[model samples]
Target: MTAVEKLLGETARADAQRNVRRLVAAAREAVAEVGVDVTAHEIARRAGVGIGTFYRRLPSREALLQAVVEDTVYEIVELAREALRDPDPWHGFCTFAAEFVQLRAMSCGINEALGTDCALSLDAPLEQLREQIRLLVERCQQSGAMRDDVPWQDVPFVLTSVMTGDRTIGLTAADDQWRRNLRVVLAGLRAQQLHTSE
Candidate 1:
């Protein structure tokens, strides 16, 4: 007999695996809707599973939060890669950056996820994304489409402002406000280049 069979019957192991997937999906909804402070009981209820099963799978709130972090990080990294494939460097950069604000209304923002109870640990993938941004920014600068004054590190702050604005300051009310704000920032990035050319 296998270790799982020794610990749990074969049917019980399969059920446990199903419960784990259910808990993960439920936790995503709960956290996205109510932030990371969502209770384990509520998550179990959403999953249509028992509290015991939920704890058996995730064990604690922090565990759920860590799972959410992992899922979201993987998703956004792929989105960034997709953006990087665009022909225009500026378009690619903005597209990836824009996702920060665009997706917040539907899911948890970066600050929220990072600030969650799980001690969110994202080192490798985040570094890759930062390097991706740096490469795109360099390409844009070389194309004469972006200002040399701005640094790649500064892009996150701009995105942070967009995310912050969307959450606290009612940017979603105007519908076009985010686009306008992004346009203004992009314009500023190119303003110096245009003046020099003229």
Candidate 2:
């Protein structure tokens, strides 16, 4: 191709990539609220682009869903890494748990997208993240900060409970009730008794 033609081709490719990012963002917002059933045209409208542009970028609704899930999963992974860096494992676990609630609540439709109706199963990455969280719990347990009898699996369950309680209790997103409830749960999670020499 001629130099001028090559330059034009590069510019067009760049524009297409920008359009793809826009569509994916819009799709994530919509799915987080309305679930994966959101229409491509709606996503296009949200992105302030034409349906043709969205189609050219994402190609299909399944593709859009996959993109959103991948983005959210990467974010979760990053948050987990940050949590692990804290010198105090329990404190890090608490912060990470709160962020998990914030992240899920930010995408209000996530419960729906994670439900059976969704086309893509973004479970594997989530499962991997869960493993990291479980390891964090195990580490804390080793320090005697957590009760050994309490299964580590309850960590994610508690995060979900925080979100659910926040929603069902009609607490404002700005409210700190979830943290308080978490504090109460944490109080119960501490090991009750230590062996003493007889």
Candidate 3:
């Protein structure tokens, strides 16, 4: 092939990859709110792309879900990392927890679809998020900002409880309540250390 033809081919390939990334991101946003059952056509419409274009990039619904789930996990992990950067370990932990709750709220349907029992192993990005949270929790415990009595396994339980509670009470009324409850839980965790010192 001529150099000009090869260069044009590479450019076209780059554009195609960019388009696929854009479609996947749009699909992720839509599915988070609506659920994975949403049709490819609906995702395509929301993405401002034709159904054919979506299908060309992702041949099946499962493929699209996998892509969207991966993206969602990556975003959540990034949020965790950002939370860990806070100066105070207690505040950092709270920030992480708050962001996590917000993500679960925004993607309620996706969370429901994944179910509590399902491990995030199938999604690499989400696995990274779990690792990040584990590290942050360890940091908080080591810093004496959090209770050593609370096991790492309990962190997921706490998050799931808050998520389930939010679902039952509804976000409008539960927002401030959850924040207060989080503070209360943190306090209880810290109480363990206080009692030990006393």
Candidate 4:
């Protein structure tokens, strides 16, 4: 390629990265204030960029939301993987569950912005994360650490419900409360197996 052509391509790629960063920052702030459903134009305005710039970077609100969701899911998956390295499966399960709940709470607004449509193609990473959680939970159950009665498919749903339910109550008191509640829930899950064995 010509020198001028290569320079133009390089500049275009750099500009695109800058625009995406600006949009992502603005979207995060807006979601914190008004929730994720905020318009892309508003996010563009907040970012001090034109609507054209926003559209050029992200084709649609769904696309933007997908980016946010993917970012959050990646973090959760990393945490889960780290937890899996723990020596005890039971402790790993508890740590994973607690961290998962906290991360979900932080990303609640973005998920809300996606609305019911959130589960569309935008949630593939989260679905994969769930599968990972299911495998981890299964490992705990197989080792007789967790309750066997709890189906693998139900792990994500139960943890999500607990976190989302706490979020709805506007409980931002402390991380201790969340951890305590999780322990209680885990106890119940364990109790189910004890009852079955007896």
Predicted structure with the largest lDDT when compared to the true one: 2
Off by over 4 Å in 4: 1-16, 110-116, 164-177, 191-198
Off by over 4 Å in 3: 1-22, 117-123, 164-177, 191-198
lDDT winner, 2 or 3: 2
Q: Considering lDDT, which of the candidate structures 1 and 4 is the better prediction for this target?
A: 4
Which pairs, if any, clash in model 1?
none
lDDT of candidates 1 onward, in order: 0.67, 0.70, 0.67, 0.68
What digit string (tens of lDDT, one per residue) describes model 4 on residues 1-198?
Answer: 422233234435777777777777787677656665678888899989999977766667766655655565666777888777888887888888888776556665644632355433545666767777877898788878887888988877677666434344665555556566666788876636555777
Better of 1 and 3 by TM-score: 1
TM-score of each: 0.75, 0.79, 0.73, 0.72
Question: Candidate 3, 133: how far from true, in Å?
Answer: 1.5
lDDT pick, better of 1 and 2: 2
Candidate 3: residue 76 lDDT (0-100)? 70
- Model 2, span 1-198: residue lDDT tens: 422233234435777767776777787789887777788888899999999876665547776677676557667767887888888877877788778777776675566554345666677767778778888788778877678887888777766666544354564553776667767776677656532311
Q: What tens digits encode model 1's per-residue C-alpha lDDT throughout 1-198? A: 322222233225677877776777777788778776688889899999888877665546675666565657666777777776888877887787778556554565345764344455667556766777778788878877777878878866676554334344542546556666767776677647576777
Tens-digit per-residue lDDT, 32-98, candidate 3:
7787667788787877888887777655656666655655666677888887898887778778787
Root-mean-square deviation (CA) per prediction: 5.7, 6.7, 6.5, 6.4
| Model 3 pairs in collision | none
What is the lDDT for 80 in model 4?
83
